[model samples]
Target: MMLFGHGDGGGGPSPAMIESLRIMQKNVPGLPDVVADTPERFFKHAASRYSGLPRWVGELYFELHRGTYTSQAMVKKGNRKAELSLRKADLLIGVFAQFRILHQNAA
Candidate 1:
């Protein structure tokens, strides 16, 4: 799986890169099949061919962005606080909705 494009900066495969792939498609001797395909299709084909591929059952920590785990402390804190706030808001909304329904029924 040769990912040919601008890494991280995101300018995706240039016309020249695409043209090069098109030119080299099935032309290179001793090389495996060289066909441009979506990641989904590639994975599907791989799964079908290699059924014994190891399955990952846990969180996939990005090895490339390991620094984020230590550097984004404030971001993680803010996200947790936001989540808690949303949960509290949901609880209050549900309580008020129930109360309103009871009051309406009583009236």
Candidate 2:
């Protein structure tokens, strides 16, 4: 998260995000792509279970911002809801990211 922001000082992605993705993939073993990238679709598909999400999470989405807001504490990474680093996010959204590039397909 810090790496996504300009003010966290030093840069790239946090180690935690990387490991989180590894674990999720490890656990699920080839999770699907279309399922992860389209959260609205996911939310609707699982509405009964997820309609309770905070309004912000359901309303907002993923986008890459290059710099921090100079005046506001809303650092480049601030106020992000479904936000994930592009690297982590690509993987988090699953199958969309070719982390290992070892296989042409992953679930």
Candidate 3:
């Protein structure tokens, strides 16, 4: 499928681009039918036509910006560390509250 747009860098298709596509769709001889369609519809049609297509059951990772991998990994690690720290703090707080309740009951 020919994707005609700015794509991941994202400015979208310009009027000139759309016009060109329209012209090609109408005037191009012996060309395969060119229709601008949503990716979802395209995939759905593909899935319906092709049996035994392997279904992906995980995160759809876009590897477009491979350059940012290290930085993104660092960010993910930081987030995980912070999440663990927060969980520990929550557990400690819960324990302390229980201890305080026990002490008050014993007094």
> What TM-score do all the candidates reach, one by one?
0.50, 0.24, 0.51
Q: What lDDT is reached at residue 18 by model 1?
A: 91
Best candidate according to lDDT:
1
What are the per-residue Cα lDDT tens digits for candidate 1 across 1-107?
A: 88999865688999999998987795688877688889999989999999999978887767788676588899999999999999998888789888774444544
TM-score of 3: 0.51
lDDT of 3 by residue, 1-107 (tens): 77877756888899999998888789488888888789999999999999789889877876785677466888889999999999998888789888774444544
Give candidate 2 regions above 4 Å deviation.
1-20, 28-37, 50-68, 72-107
Order the numbered candidates by TM-score, best leading. 3, 1, 2
The global C-alpha lDDT for each of the candidates, from Candidate 1 onward, is: 0.84, 0.50, 0.82
How would you order the candidates by lDDT, starting with the best? 1, 3, 2
Candidate 3 backbone collisions, by pair: none
Candidates 1 and 2 compared: the better one by lDDT is: 1
